[model samples]
Target: MNRKELEQRLRQELALPYYNAKIAERDYSESEFQEMKAQLQADIEQYARDYVNESNANG
Candidate 1:
């Protein structure tokens, strides 16, 4: 998804109500979720780079 779609989906997911209190529950607001979405996207990019580097190095 693009940046706008990610931001929109994050807001929609945050609006969902929680049915149970679990320790693994995320307690972030809409803004925080947006930030997390960006961070995760960045992480995926970094992971791909790392994988490519490792593969090239091994080859």
Candidate 2:
């Protein structure tokens, strides 16, 4: 997915109000942004694995 879509998913998964703001107003530091990106990537990978596992189990 694109950056915006990823951010939206991350926001939902994180359930944090800080992520609900507009990108420009978020004003996160470089390190913080990197950390969030890493977390998002990890979460996405985990979700993919879960989906595959669930599908296999159901199939």
Candidate 3:
């Protein structure tokens, strides 16, 4: 699927009660665990930067 469709699906799924638990478990892996954690950390940092930029723009 495309980005828009994928995001829409994610938004829909996130509305469910068990979304957080299952979503975290879906990334489960024994060997690639460190890589996943690093990737997720980078993703969070990038998002924070984007949010800061948007806030500065609005302010």
Best by TM-score: 2
lDDT of 2 at 10: 60
- Which 10 successive residues of model 1 have the least lDDT summed? 16-25
Q: What global local distance difference test value does model 2 have?
A: 0.65
lDDT of 3 by residue, 1-59 (tens): 43334334444643432223123323334344445345555766899999999999999
Error of 3 at 56 (Å): 0.1
Candidate 2 RMSD computed on C-alpha atoms after optimal superposition onto the true structure: 8.5
- The backbone clash count of each candidate, in order, is 0, 0, 0
User: Higher lDDT: candidate 1 or 3?
Assistant: 1
- Candidate 3 whole-model C-alpha lDDT, 0 to 1: 0.50
The TM-score values for the models, in the order shown, are 0.53, 0.57, 0.51
Model 3: worst 10 consecutive residues (lDDT sum): 16-25
Tell me the tens digit of each residue's lDDT in model 2 across 1-59.
Answer: 44565466567656644564345534455566668767766876899999999999999
Better of 1 and 2 by TM-score: 2
Candidate 1 to truth, TM: 0.53
Against the reference, the lDDT scores of all candidates come to 0.57, 0.65, 0.50
